[model samples]
Target: MSRKENAASLVQDYAEVFICPVCGDTVEVVELKSVVCPKRHTFDFAKQGYINISTRSMKVNYDKELFAARENIIMKHKLYDPLHTRLLEVIKVEAANNPRSLLLDAGAGEGSHLAKILDQMKTVTGIGIDISKEGIRLAASKSEKAMWLVGDLANIPVKDQSLHTIINILSPANYQEFKRVLIENGLMIKVVPGANYLIELRDTILEEQKRFFTNEETISLFKQHYSDVQIEELTYTKELHQEELRDLIKMSPLSWNAEQESINEVRNREHFGITIDLAILIGKNR
Candidate 1:
């Protein structure tokens, strides 16, 4: 069997804690005990330490190359690190001691952000759902500590009111599904680029389309669904080498529409630096 076929539960150790995704009831885990709701819904926690929380299929064209670009950019500390660090700090401070706090990463690509958050909190489990199977496969390969599924963000697979924190990292949001799965005071965190974000890279990729999102506009959307909306813009500059710079260009959606030859030219150019205008929004589900 290939490594893909050999994927299994990360461990057999589990606490006496479980939640019914349908009714939002708390359940206990006994040895060899599979999850069974009062309504007779049963979900067995795989030995691989994850769950299949997606109810429907979501099709997409993302392949290994896309997931690699995402992972490479993240590892280089150029684009995602600042936002990723903020997420870890927020979860540790706000939702640390809940008897049960399920972290659902809506557009989790390769499961890096969710995995980092899990490491920061002592007792937390996460479900990473992506539209691409290749993304989940890479995540599962990295650590059996988290669960990965091939699903879409618009339609989540878990029970209602079952989450403590939900992270949308440069991904799409399904606010209605989020409201259903969150407690009254549960938090939703989002990271989007500021208008001037990655201008250097955009110079080559954005052909006067102006695709940057407005922080206030996003805040308004969140306000439409969630209350106590708070928005902060983090601006920082990073130094980069040629290889790291090349990876950043390869991984972004901006590169997708660019001519392949032009992309190659940009990738081959020498060392460069880019300023990142990252906006973070955190709020409650009203």
Candidate 2:
């Protein structure tokens, strides 16, 4: 089947999980082409195989090139293999008593992270939602296993208390919206950057301002929004060639504000060693 057909099939199978972005009414797949709600708010699936369910217009800085670089770094370079493994381990432990029927990857950029995690599981169905149409389109092109959609985090286009698990990785979070979609006692795994994450890149491009960072404020905020909060720290380094380093620089936000000279200097290096430090937070709904 084509990507559109496959996406339609998946949407039909899990139609009950969706809601109209405008009216908040239950949604249904219509004739395998579109989703419609009782109040007549409708969204059509794109030819690329993803649905656009966003309610309002918003500016997004991420572009197609950024997602392409990210895909190469995550899927081809395998820099995030350790992180994915840890996530899988956590998911298994946290949901030991219940079956992980459905998982929502909020702010799922290019869908690589979600795709990687779902690859190891046999029964879990994943829904990758992102505000960037470019990211969602690229994601849909790569995988038909998970449903990809262009959606806003402020108003997730999913039913209340419907998700079995929610994973947020290196993306913004809407805790209230997440709580609304997550089932009672459901699992939430959030990954935040550690103090020394990408220290090499920071030193090269960020200079003096590249001093060790902290996620204390973020951790405190998460604890306030979530219950049974637990943190797991994973730190490591990966060797990257010039091309890989270029892609990494393009994919990360740290280089966004750096001077072109600094970015060029880092990317032109023969080989670079980069640190991957992350704090994985696990929590459950009350």
Which digits, one per residue and each the tens of the lDDT, describe model 2 over residues 105-216? 9999899998988888767888999988889998888777789989888888888898888999988899999999998988988899998899888888886855568999
| Runs in model 2 lying further than 4 Å from the true structure | 94-100
Colliding pairs, model 2: none
**Top lDDT model:** 2
Per-candidate RMSD, Å:
4.4, 1.4
Candidate No. with top TM-score? 2
* C-alpha lDDT of candidate 2 relative to the true structure: 0.88
Which 10-residue window in model 1 sums to the lowest lDDT? 8-17
> TM-scores for all candidates?
0.80, 0.96
Per candidate, the number of residue pairs that clash is 7, 0
Give Cα distance to truth, residue 68, candidate 2, Å.
Answer: 0.7
